[model samples]
Target: MKRIPMEIKVLIAIFLAGVISVLWYVYDTKAKRRAEAAAPTPISQPIDP
Candidate 1:
């Protein structure tokens, strides 16, 4: 079997990292949006004791 070139291996590693980063961004954004949506709004507090 022939050994792979170092340059090509480095390129492939960089590409995979980019894909993983994009996927994570999407996942985190969705999670944050959902959490914000499900959270309750704060009510105004009375000043009088």
Candidate 2:
């Protein structure tokens, strides 16, 4: 088996990290939107004398 160089390994790691972060961001944004949508809106009350 051939040995991989350190530079190539570092590049691969960086690329994988970038991809994972992007996926996480997309997932988080969608979850927040879903939560917001499922939440109830507050109604304004009129002041009575």
Q: How much lDDT does each candidate structure score?
A: 0.83, 0.84
Can you give the lDDT of residue 41 in candidate 1? 44
Question: Which residue pairs clash in candidate 2?
Answer: none
Error of 2 at 4 (Å): 0.4
Clashes of each: 0, 0
* TM-scores for every predicted model: 0.78, 0.78
Poorly placed runs, candidate 2 (over 4 Å)? 41-49
lDDT of 2 at 33: 77
Candidate 1 lDDT over 1-49, as tens digits, reads: 9999999999999999999999999999888778767867422334467
Q: Give residue 33's error in model 1 in angstroms.
A: 0.4
